[model samples]
Target: MIRTLIGALGGLVVALLILGVLATFGVWDSIGRVASILGGLVLGMVFGQLGIFIAVWRE
Candidate 1:
């Protein structure tokens, strides 16, 4: 559990660093619409996978 937490935090840090670089290049400014679309895509995938697993587990 602790390892999972540490790994997640490290991943977040790396993501932030990459975002910082993108922001410096002005990619952040144009990412508003893309961000929403990507977030929705990821959320859909995550929940969809969870729903699939639960359905299968119920069998």
Candidate 2:
């Protein structure tokens, strides 16, 4: 549980970093695209946590 929570926090930090880079480069400059990217980031984090939990459980 603690590992999953930490993973989530790390994912959020990574999302913010990616968003910062996009804004800095003037890339993907649309509300819908930004939303989509954010959605994907969240989804990726969820799947990543699931995978982590599975791995830890199997160990």
Candidate 3:
């Protein structure tokens, strides 16, 4: 359970980092708010699942 929590947090950090990079490149301006949010949500879930998989696999 602790591993799962750590993995999820790590994933969220990664998602935020990617979003930050996109924002730096002004991608958010072209995409609009709703689309950007949806993109972030998708990224979060994908990365979160990947993180969880890796964590569990390591066990």
TM-scores for all predictions: 0.54, 0.56, 0.50
Tens digit per residue, CA lDDT, model 3, 1-59: 56666666676777678767777888865546745675678677767777777777888
Q: By how many angstroms RMSD does model 2 differ from the true structure?
A: 3.9
What stretches of model 1 exceed 4 Å from their correct place?
Answer: 1-25
lDDT of 3: 0.70
Best of the two (1, 2) by lDDT: 2
Candidate 1 differs from the real structure by a C-alpha RMSD in angstroms, to one decimal, of 5.7
Looking at model 1, the pairs that clash are none
Q: What is the C-alpha RMSD of each candidate to the true structure, in Å?
A: 5.7, 3.9, 5.7
Q: Candidate 2: lDDT of 11?
A: 82
lDDT (Cα, tens digit) per residue for candidate 1, span 22-55: 6778887667765566556555655665666566
**lDDT value, candidate 2, whole model:** 0.79
- For all candidates in order, the CA lDDT equals 0.59, 0.79, 0.70
Full candidate order by lDDT, most accurate first = 2, 3, 1
- Model 2: runs farther than 4 Å from truth? 28-31, 43-59
Ranking by TM-score: 2, 1, 3
